[model samples]
Target: MISDEELMALMRYVDGECTDEEATAIRAQLAHDPAYRRAYNEVRQADEALAALPLLEPSTGFNFRVLNQLKAEPHKAVSPISLRKRLLHISGIAIFLLVLPSVLLLLSSGQNPVLILDGSWLPAVGDRQAQVALGPYLQPLLFVNGLLTLLLFDRGVLQPWFRQRHQPPA
Candidate 1:
């Protein structure tokens, strides 16, 4: 069987890319070796067949049609701020607002003796004084606020930061 280097040399010679010395060596081999001669003839025949085929030309309106098609298609615009990110920011702000009132009520509860003395500040519930005080609900509210704060930090801050770090550069 003919080697890859011999075949490549034959191709280069057929394409008129070989030096005089290389072409001389290949010509000598082709004359002496039947396999080399056959391979060389096959390569020459294929090149000649390809060269004989007519070259194709595009229509006169090809460029205009392509440009018109490109213009007809709508290009999607990428927004700088995504809807999900906006919603996350707005929700984080709202959660912060909710947490503020609970925090203030909890903190001011100890200092404000007048509010504690008068349960009348809380509206009555159907002929009975509303036994429900801010004291009991404050701890649970703070707990929920802590959870929301953690959620906000994770979704709004850590997730986006991590995604940005791991993304493949454009």
Candidate 2:
């Protein structure tokens, strides 16, 4: 016939988990009920007995226990290198595409227009032309690829590495 609040208060008294206000309420109730007071006394005695029990340091194998649990767990493998390699390979290909043409035209052919279609630059580059042609594209592409690199590896590589490094060095 006890209310939830009353039962919880009684349980807290039993478990030695009651705050001062909770204990006061429970005490007030016990003053009105002799049977409840007896029960409360018994629980209080049991809680105090438990508190008086001896304490000991944790076992040496606790670290190993945690390590074993981690080892037992199955985790999904995520790799950013593949994506970065793809982007870098693409970027390298783009570089080879642009620069290779200009270099070959300047060196082997010596201003030949016939090999113009095959990776050869007909229009010579100037300072303004460099910025106008490739700067905008390359800068943004590199930044985006770098951001993608950060996103791909942050959860897998960065978080774990930082956690490992800062974990009290045990």
lDDT string for model 1 (45-154, tens) is 99999999999877869977887676454454646666577577768768778777867776676842222344455566333443335666666777787788778778
Q: Which stretches of candidate 1 lie over 4 Å from their true place?
A: 67-170
Clashes found in each candidate (C-alpha, N, C closer than 3 A):
0, 1
Q: Give the clashing pairs for model 1.
A: none
Question: Once superposed on the true structure, which residue ranges of model 2 sit more than 4 Å away at CA?
Answer: 1-5, 14-16, 56-170
Residue 140 Cα positional deviation in candidate 1, in Å, after optimal superposition = 69
Residue 69, candidate 2: alpha-carbon lDDT? 73
